[model samples]
Target: MRTRTNGIQLLRNGERSVDKQYRGQRIFERLGNVSQAEAEDWLKQRQAAVDAQHANQLREGDEQLFAAAAAKYLTECQQRGVRTLETISYHVQILLPYIGGMRLRDVCNDSLEAFKDARVTEDGVKNITVNRSLEVVRTVLNRAARVWRTNGKPWLSTSPLIEMLDEKGQERPPRPISWGEQAGLISRLPAHLQRMVLYTVNTGARDDNVCGLRWDWEVPVPELQRSVFVIPSEHYKGKRPHVQVLNDVAWSVVQECRGMHDDYVFVYRRERVKNVEDEPVMPYDRIDTMNNTGYQAARKAAGLVGVRIHDLRHTFGQRLREAGVPEEDRALLLGHAIEGMPQHYATSTIARLVDLANSVTQTRDRTTLLRVING
Candidate 1:
């Protein structure tokens, strides 16, 4: 005998039977009484109910569930090899204070616009700072969308809140140090730092490159005869290898610094040193001490008002132009990438760089330079 109850069919298996209650529903079975057909039908119905429930939950458009998206985005950033952990952490901190609890879907264009306005007017933030903050938000959201797409979810198509801020009309005022000022500043610095300052002024090398210089990296090529600082790609701002030719003055500075620090080229301790086992150690205090006392006192004594340590780099570019070096050569010496070439283009040889620096030094008449300085 067979019986149909709530669309389930049961058959008698010779003589035994059992009754079961599941989820407020009663079911009956006998030994071999419930056919495979009946089991299949029940499973299909249960699955359909589950699917319907899921569809309803998704339709609610709740953002609370997407909190994990930010964490996933941060993990992805770490994997992508972001060099500055402090910079990334700062960006994350700024965004979290503003929208940490908000869902990805809740962050629309309007919300972002309001945030920008608040940052600029209310917080008195600079445009560049605000621009960077927006970039952090945009990167995270874009990463989230990508992760969702990779996981086969279609809920997110793109980041809705972030876009480039228009900067077509804004122009920055020129801020290069004058040649007379450079000479005065150079004269005031201690004999040790004078060469470093000159090299920085001539080549526009950043503070780190100037201070972090090492002797082993200084190679004297036969053709050039003069030693050149070979900045490894990893240490360079462009993340590419480059060679900076040292002029007579700059090379003299290197030699002097070499005498002071036997192992390292520069006197200041390198930020992030390595031990005998070749593990990186924390940055030392020497560089900061040099910057605050020695560098600052020299600048003040020189009477070079409004000058910064980095102004030497600007002076380098300006002096290059004054010396009649072409724009292309100037850009090359500054370690900037030329259009149509990759960032890692071969750097100028030590001889050529020396010639270029010497040309700038030779062209200016000392008497005329004095007249300008006196004026």
Candidate 2:
């Protein structure tokens, strides 16, 4: 008589044997009086070894697809918590339609020419946008050739020299809104958005910084009788701690929004009412960005068709220059990276910056700029 399991059988001679085909490979082995559970464990180990060997054999440069490499690259980026990972992923998706099926060995500058043409002529995107996508492709190929490897063999033999299109005159100049234009734009926006836009113009902060500003980042200074916000590197564009000194206007905006939200400085008031009989429950939610539909609609209503959210920042910089603020102080106030300057500000330096920032608040300090509208 013989006792049989799924893949193992005990023979009359008190020995066990496994006869099974796994992944098209025959697993045949005999053991001396081993239990069925023990035999199953041996089978599992054999399968894992076979899988590893197959993976190594399939990881050849010519066999691996750019799609696979792109997937791996995205995984690595996500794992590293890359700040611009979302944008990188968007670029990868755009490139995939053209290069996804190509073998890693076949990806090169010549193969990407059609993609560039389609993006420029058909998609009507600027050379800079296309260049950004090409940069992602270059990054993925470089990583495959240098970092990613299997069985001591690189995923790619070498990365090709990917050249970017000439963007010399294709770039759009920054549009700094006039005080009159700012008034028109701000007046057209919703109350909450008006405050956020005003804050950005006053502080020269980017859209992300203004929207992501937190209350906890505010540091009190008894010496100056005011507080300044210090943004962490992770939240800032420069990848360094940035100190934001609020001017009188920005501070007043802060005061208007004080105690509205426990965490965020700028937020949208969302009113909820289930029934007419009940009172409206107003909840303040964090604003993701100042460049939302409200800002766009307001700009449209104000007839500032060429204005962008970033123009608010330029407006502040331009006003500071017109107010006779020095270049170094302007750089510091605008949160531009200055060499040899500490990220943390001294109270005295903060006081001076506050004064300089307050100078732009005067209506008389203005420059007549000829705004060039781009087609």
Candidate 3:
């Protein structure tokens, strides 16, 4: 005989049993010799309990475990193709012990404070480090409230407020590279790295933009009698299109990189592993994302410990100012949206941008630049 128990079902199969959902989990219960009416009554009571739990009148019968929620969050991130999935997963593993079993409702200010203290006092973690972990946690919870849902109920009524610790003391001042330091640093780098650095400094492009640049994005501008890179709105920051006119020096680097790789404009030689297969292969067009750790040894050898690859962009912006390029023209050539202007500009604006780009193409002693790499 088949028996009903709320949304669950109970039937005779050599024993009396019921199947039901409890706290978002499927459970099988065996009630030996119990009547079908009894199982139905039990299920009704459980449903009432769940209602109370959701009403905040009880803490039992309904719980969202942190570990389970984290799994759901990671799945969403994977679907979105977040590049930091592996890194975030590693951090989640580290955080499991602190919050794996806690109910979602129990994640209050005190609980977060305790987690922070444990990380700082016992694990000796820095505040900034703790903040990054908190960022991942915050992101997961925010999605649960704002986007995640099941059966018309959001995983959370609202996302918890995550306050970031003040990092005033840890904030490093910006370092704009001088031409001489650029000369020295580039000389010590490998041929591929040298070109990447040179291209970045000249074009004012971020490391990711430089690395992710593809040949298909380049468009021939017959009006300007040359080609320019036009990064799509999605790829550029602020979701706006970025147009870059290749200066004389930067264009030379691109020409040399032609045919080196099938798609990417920049590629580095990856050394083979010792005795591991025939070759220790590395991915092409890859940027050392950990703040350029691979280039540290070369940077130190050049006696520039404080310099960073990002400073190359700053160098470009500064050089533009030094050369008396107007702010509006500089911003245009450097691929930033012109604020306070109509979305559409006159056709002559392209010529204006090209003129400003050529103005900065004037480098100090092209011979010195060529000699630095022994080219």
Candidate 4:
């Protein structure tokens, strides 16, 4: 029996099948013992799949541009909730001016020479910085060739080799600051920044984690009479949840920050603009980064040149080692990736970590072996 829906019919044996021709293609689907509506739905789905496959085949051809592939890569990254989407987008924007118009197949190492030269000479960026941009380009091209497929045809024939610039001599060693240097740098910074720096040095949390720290991540441990921030896997660099164990000094800083902001732990109070919307000025606003204009001015005034925000984390790790804390404890305190270790920590373990962290607080007893070499 033929249904009103085209290409859907009931067989003599009470079976149903969809026999349809879509876009110059035959789609024959046998849906067993199904109703006319089911046959119709099957036909609709099959035809849609065929249409999409055809569209993909048409789109992912030799005419594909680097910009188009980059857009697709970024969309996939955003959909997957990639933590470094903003950084990737920045690299894409830098690449677009050079390879936006270039065909996917044409974006080889040879073609990238001009962009590399421009970045090194015109932009005055280091080879390592240029390498980061190149790495993004390599990632996009690799995804296009290996992952993205259209009608069994890959987006590109092959991903070309992207040579990274040698960073042997250009590499800068970690500058772990001394306690005296820390005092000078901390005193020069603003109150909000000062708290953040202290928090970072105590916890060894990265700049992003420090800046994005929320009150909600804090889990109170009444047994220990303290709280620790539990960073979700999505928010952390290691793709695993990190427990931000606070020592006595870090806990003290946290106490000072309590009731300051409902959302963020550290925040700055900016002066209200004349015609802008009036917002609450009591709790202040979330700080984007500790490496802002105020931080730069403070560092300069304090004569702490070439000192990056990341050095605070280095200082923490250095101090922990100097305090004679165990290597495994240092790894956990610094949030370093430990294989086969569970994310959730017991109260006892938390207490032990807190003790290890406190050892660094009293820098007076620790050796000052960190030589300050300004770049």
Worst 10 residues of 3 by lDDT: 53-62
Candidate 4's TM-score reads 0.79
TM-score of each candidate? Answer: 0.61, 0.79, 0.68, 0.79
Q: Candidate 3's error at 239, in angstroms?
A: 2.9
Candidate 4: tens digits of C-alpha lDDT, residues 122-196: 989999999999999999999988999878898888889999998887878788777877889899987888999
Candidate 3, position 309, lDDT: 72
lDDT of each: 0.62, 0.86, 0.71, 0.86
* lDDT string, candidate 2, 1-375, tens digits: 335556777888878888877777888888778887787788789889888656744767656888888888999989988867888999999999999978888999999999999999999999999999999999999998899887788877788899999998787787888778888998999999999889998999998888889999999999877799999998889999999999989999998999989999998875544564565566789987787888899999999887888988998998898889999999998989888868988888999999999988774524344353333
List of clashing residue pairs for candidate 1: 233-240
| Tens-digit lDDT track of model 3 for 54-87 | 5443322226777777887888778977656777
Model 2 TM-score on a 0 to 1 scale: 0.79
Clashes of each: 1, 0, 0, 0
Cα error of candidate 1 at position 154, Å: 7.4
Of candidate 1, the 10-residue stretch with the lowest lDDT total is 281-290
Off by over 4 Å in 4: 1-59, 272-283, 365-369, 372-375
